[model samples]
Target: MRKLLVELGGTRAVAEMHDDIVPKTCDAVWRVLPVEGMAIHANWSSREIMLHLHGEKILRLPPEGPVRRGTTAPGDIVYFWRSPQMSRGKQLAYSSEFQRELSELAIFYGDPAGGGLAADDPARSGRDSNLQVSTLFATLIDIPREFARKCEDVRHTGLQRLLVTRLGQ
Candidate 1:
């Protein structure tokens, strides 16, 4: 099981990749290690923050394994890609490259995840039918309270520098 270190400001957490079930996805994510960017909170997905992949760091990987379509738990780290045609207006938070097409690492940090709102949101529902691809490649071993709080802060405080790196590198 390969591990990853995810850092946000002063908070940090470790995640273990589900390589046994999603080898290809795991390898792809591992190759993009040391990715740092301004992360934004999700308006549609609750308790989630996203690190948008820009420039050469963007990955357009295919769906692999028996990925869980809907329903996500806290500590779920997923690789999500949205096709160029799926733009929901100007992606002001993302770069030019991601305006039309997007590749992002989404970190689900709390309960009521995969829902659309802070409460139960059946509108988006985290369904596979809507997303081009959402592959759950890793999950945090333990979600620290501080880390979760920091992620929640992004919703109010604006973009924050988030970094993801391969463990023991």
Candidate 2:
């Protein structure tokens, strides 16, 4: 398994890519190693931290095979791909119907008991179901409860320097 090290300020979190299940997505992320971006609390869910990459480059890869959708747990890393036409209108549109554009990665760090269908109900799927098909590519394998709590504490404060890099070089 491929491991990734995520540093939020002084704290650290480690995640393992599920290459066996999401080979395409894992390969895409591996190609873009050592990425730094802004980590912010997700407006849709308090359990999620949104990692906004610093570029117009949208991460996209062909579906490797049949995969589960919307099911996530604490430490799960997800990739939400934006559509190309998402910015061309009076309002932003999010849907699986449009061509893929940029990608937004989210790390879940909330109570598992508090997550379920409500965490991803259709009505809560992006701004008008645009995120009905986001991909789950990895899961935190060595994250501690303290680190998870730190992430939750900054859920509202916003992290300015979130760094993601492959472990051991």
Candidate 3:
């Protein structure tokens, strides 16, 4: 399986792509290797942090694999895209580019991820369409304690540098 090294606040974790289950999604993500940016914590999705994509790095792809209402697990990495701000709340922390077209690499770091809308926005849960799509592309093989702590720190301390690079590259 293809793997990636996810780094945040000087700590690191390893994730293996779900290439066998979602080949197209995996391929698309793999092509855009070494994604680096300031990761902001998720407001709706508990225990999650997001790395927003901008400019040419933004990937606009259709959803792949089965649609899951809930059942989001810890260490799951998702390729998420949402058109504009259709939801009730505003994404104030995101960049201006994302305000128009939001593209994100979502990392599930800790508790509250295994079930419910902690992996999704409640307002937009059942409404799956081109307007919004989230594809589970990878799963972290090992979530280091320090890495998890740094991800949690984003909630209090604000945005932190997050990098995702192809393993063995």
* lDDT of all predictions: 0.85, 0.67, 0.85
**Model 3 whole-model lDDT (C-alpha atoms):** 0.85
- lDDT, model 2: 0.67
TM-score against truth, every candidate: 0.89, 0.75, 0.90
For 69-144, candidate 2 gives per-residue lDDT tens digits of: 5557778887766555543453222333223355667788775412555355655465765533367888888668
Candidate 3, after superposition: displacement of residue 59 in Å? 0.5
Report the Cα lDDT for residue 30, model 1: 92
lDDT, residue 93, model 2? 28
Candidate 3 residue lDDT tens string, 1-169? 9999999989999999998889999999999887999999887788889998887888998989989676678899999887765544675777666646778899999988735453445656655555787899999997899999999999999999999999985
Ranking by lDDT: 1, 3, 2
Better of 1 and 2 by lDDT: 1
- Runs of candidate 2 with Cα error greater than 4 angstroms are 84-102, 112-133
TM-score of 3: 0.90
Query: Each candidate: how many clashes?
Result: 0, 3, 0
Q: What TM-score would you give candidate 2 relative to the actual structure?
A: 0.75
Pairs clashing within candidate 1: none
